[model samples]
Target: MVARTTDTPVGRVKPCRLIGLEQHHDERGSLSIVESEWTTGFPIRRIYYLHNTRTGTARGAHAHRALEQLFVAAHGSFTVKVDDGHRQRAYRLDDPGTGLYVGPMVWRDITDFSDDSVCLVLASEHYDETDYYRDYAAFLEDVRRQP
Candidate 1:
């Protein structure tokens, strides 16, 4: 895995990928499955998909405290903005075979849809409202004070 620079508030971005998952296609359609230990370093505990998004609409305007996520544009195209409280990075995702692994402590927002965009998220944990930092100002201070 390699880290790439993003337009996020954080100055650096770490890229990672898990193995043992494949996209299967046939005349019927397509299917994908994530198995345990598939990701080399990050372990997934939950999986979710977002669909039926309208063009120019945006979603996800919060940051996670402990959960890590891999965001994939399953259908169509969309842009994701990642903020690490110091720097922010933007990613354009349109490929079904690729994904952007976002670590904890980063604020993320998905937008700029191409009319048929669908986002699939692989999470390291289940939903927890307390684990999220929705306020940008607070997030920035938290990252700044982190040792």
Candidate 2:
């Protein structure tokens, strides 16, 4: 059944998405490709990679006000947890040919990184401190205020 406003937090907001990429191989090697506005559904303005995360560690425990991101596991595997104030979802990223698309106003974090994991993030905007909601309560309040 579909969840309603009284049952779900951020009731009117769009949920995150999992997207597949194209993989081309011809015995030489393999290439995985993703394009902004095509696969990501958002234009990218910034790019970064995360690595060397110690075991049992986590990062990115915050939400953006108006930024979108696509995460690709270019090397190994990791888990991403997303919270929309009223609900939560988890995704395992283990393939370079796949990506998880996270929209704004959603809290997300990365954990369970394999020893060789390399996570690449393509962002829709540049960094801005005002665009971030680092506190869970504040994020919830903000999400509820949206129309």
Candidate 2's TM-score reads: 0.89
Task: Give the alpha carbon lDDT tens digit for every residue of 1-147 in model 2.
Answer: 111223233313556777889889898999999887888888888999999989998999999988899989999999988888767777889989889888888998888899999999999999899999999898989887867
lDDT (tens digit, per residue) of candidate 1 on 1-147:
222374223423343332334679899987765554564246888889888887667899988887888877778878777777667667788877667777788888888878787888888898999999989899888888876
Once fitted onto the true fold, the runs of candidate 1 whose alpha carbons sit more than 4 angstroms away are: 1-33
TM-score of predicted structure 1: 0.78
For all the candidates, what are their Cα RMSDs to the real structure? 4.0, 4.4
Model 2 stretches with alpha carbons more than 4 Å out: 1-12
**Please, what is the whole-model Cα lDDT of each candidate in the order they appear?**
0.73, 0.83
